[model samples]
Target: MADPRPATPTDLPLIIVAIATCLALVVFTAPLTTLDAMTDALGLSPGAQAWIMSGMPLGAACGLLTAGALGDTLGRRRTFVAGLWLTAASSVAAALSVNGLMLIVMRVVQGLGSAGIMACGLGLLGQVYDGQARRRAAAVWAAALGAGVAVGPLIASGLLAVSGWTATHWAVAAVSAALAVMAMSRLPESDRTGDRVDIGGSVLLIAGLACLMSALIEVRVGSTGLVTALLIGAVVLLGLFWRIERRTGNPILALELFRYPDFSGATLAAFASGAGVLALMSMVPTALVRGMGQSPMSAAVILLAWSGVTVVAALASGRLPERLTPRQRVIGAIAGCGVGQALMLAAGTGTSWAVVLPGLLIAGVSNGILNASLGHEAVQTVPPERAAMGSAANNTARYLGSALGIALISVLIAQKSGAGTDFFDAWHAAVIASTAFSVLGVLAMLVVSRPRGVVR
Candidate 1:
């Protein structure tokens, strides 16, 4: 069929992208709420569990590095459909895994699929909408993305309560399969660019990230020599990757984007946003179930306040004055996150979820605002030709932060509460560590030196 009438915010194409992106993003955290049950069933140690949680985001960071090139080489629609199918297959495989390691590996593959969908889904939206219409569409997309992060645990908890931990994976598989069919029937294909692929850079980045995360996770097990070796390897590989990007034509990542202060600041804010928000999401269920002795359904209901407010705030952030400088918006939003996390820190072990409600509400709203501002700033800071790379870089930072954050939180909690220490005390310390990341992000933004001719 000749392409449908001009794309609008409510068009079927945009709707499809929104839903796919939401599902893909949700996969990052859906397993968290159900993790306690999953661990029991799979015979997972704490170290194994942390790796399982970190695996998907690390895989996603790798996928973001190269998914753009894959989209440019393969037709976008083809890549999207393939990604959905891959998600379906991996989710099913995850559901069937009999061991912790197998489940972790499958989750990584699932994340790879998720990354492909997220990268291309946005690209599709950009291609379809422009001008003010594009702005509205982008706002809707950002809201959906935040909604995914906020509500993923509730969905996971509900599924686990009804049909056990495997239900979550099976449900994801079913949804992805259905989306794949929808894409085949209704989605329009974007033209292919066949740009020179950046295979070497992509490989180096993935290997470096994997080694780094593996070192972090293994550190929890007190594997000193292995951790040292892995950490050194990671640094060497990442250093080489940076050197390669500086020299190569058609680099996977353009190093020049960092020269713009707004771009650098916004990217760092995005990273901290991901680390603080997602680490909280991943750990809350553990606190409720393992620390406080609550059921998954009850945990979900308690978290409802956090997720609901986030959705509302995310949509509201889009309505703020367009004249607000990206720097101002990002600085305010990240600072708010710091304040909110500090409030959460005050809610100690004996306090009920109600005691933490105010903090969650504040943090949720700030997260929404940060999400919108970072996305807008990331785009505005880059030249039009570099927009795709900018988005990829922003997401890469976010996912990488998430992986690192989860690993760090796990290690900190373990180290703080060794044999004989209270679990809740350790949990409190971990929360503080996440709060520190928000402060660090704020400080990084404060020091960002904007380039000449750039808007503050």
Candidate 2:
């Protein structure tokens, strides 16, 4: 079929997508500041708390690749609008959750919805914008991501002060509903021809990731038998997924894309960002509140130093000298984040929240650059029609890394806590581990950097 809309302007679509992307991140990070209250109200155990935190990322990891393929094959507008409705409905369900398990399930569903929004939203932008315009749009999308992280805690804190954690969900639900309606009416439709969704590959990939995440969560609870079984299952299922993708005509993830060094570099950067900075930052609120006896609102405000600066830095990234390639920017940004993580070390029980402010601000700037560069690289690395697939692949690595990182951090914290270490000390260990992941990421990127040409 020919294009349904005649020369649609990019501005309106960019606005709608930026809002949806912002809202998705808002939902993802809101729980960070509100975890203590949510835990107390739900009567959650430590294991359950970890699950609630990591569940959404796991779901996104599972759904993003499939969602992207579907969006490209079916219709971007259809997929985007459907994702908004799903998110709105899931927020209401989360608000009504009665227990830890119920809320965890709801969170996973919300993540699936978010996967659709993120994959299709970026795809829509790539469809409408080209060259320098695409770069600017990517930067704007990156800024929206930072803005959401900066604002989510404040929104949650304000609502929690007035009502409770559920109120935040209710507010999210309202905004999501409004966005869905707007998207359905205003967004232009775009879809590629001659591509079919890979049902077998999607099933295998999702199941494998689910098994891996389950094992990670179960390992913390000392369920060695279950963890072992899940790990074995994950290996087998993921191995099968790889085989199927290699053989299938319509693979959900095209293995050929990984041949490009820039693509591989971008994926590595995303994973490192998730596992290192994003994971460490997610735990900061808990540490501030539990370890340092800071109030929830106080923790949120302190985090704003990091997340707020991220927005400014992301918006400003487009202004950086043209000499810096996206890969170079990503490498430098991640390395900067590692340094920031090191600067944040040695926070003992008596340390003030202000001790980490400088580090947070530095890392926030680095994170902004990373986000914008990754957003640009995700689409630029792939064939034009496969922009959604590229976005999905990049995000799959990100959320999967995040799930693993959160689990690892939880395990490290729990081990230290079990050994009678204080919260701050345990957090110090987690920070070190996270920083190590960043270092590894930088090394990997450096290795990929040996190649000289851009993929596109």
The lowest-lDDT stretch of 10 consecutive residues in candidate 2 is 1-10
Q: Candidate 1, residues 1-456: lDDT per residue as tens digits? A: 112368653587777877887887678878667878989898999778877877787778877757755665565678778889999999999999999989999988988898778767766666677765565556566777867766777788778889999998898899999989988878777776667777899899889988887886787774789999999999999999999999887777788878888788888887887787657655675566666667776766666566666666666775677676557767788888777777766555566667667777787788777776676665667765555566677888888787678777777666555322377677777888888888888888889835233232
As a whole number from 0 to 100, the lDDT of residue 187 in candidate 1 is: 79
Look at candidate 2 and tell me the lDDT of residue 126: 88
Checking candidate 2 for backbone clashes, the offending pairs are none
Q: How many backbone clashes does candidate 2 have?
A: 0
- Expressed as tens digits, the lDDT of each residue in 1-456 for candidate 2 is 112345455577788899999998988888876888999999988878878877877788889998888888888888888888998899999999989999999999998999999988888888888877778788889889988989987988888889999998998889888988888877878856667789999999999999998888788874788999999999999999999999998788989989988888888888999899988887787677777778878888888888988888888887888777777888899999898887778566677878888889899999988998899989888888788889999989988787778888888777665322366677888899999989988998999844444322
Q: Per-candidate TM vs. native?
A: 0.89, 0.93
Backbone collisions counted per model: 0, 0
**Residue 48 in candidate 1, Cα distance off native in Å:** 2.9
Task: Estimate every model's Cα lDDT from 0 to 1.
Answer: 0.75, 0.85
Highest lDDT against the true fold, candidate = 2
State, as a TM-score between 0 and 1, how close model 2 is to the true structure: 0.93
The residue ranges of model 1 lying beyond 4 angstroms of the native Cα positions read 1-10, 72-75, 184-188, 290-293, 416-425, 449-456
Q: How does residue 54 of candidate 2 score in lDDT?
A: 73
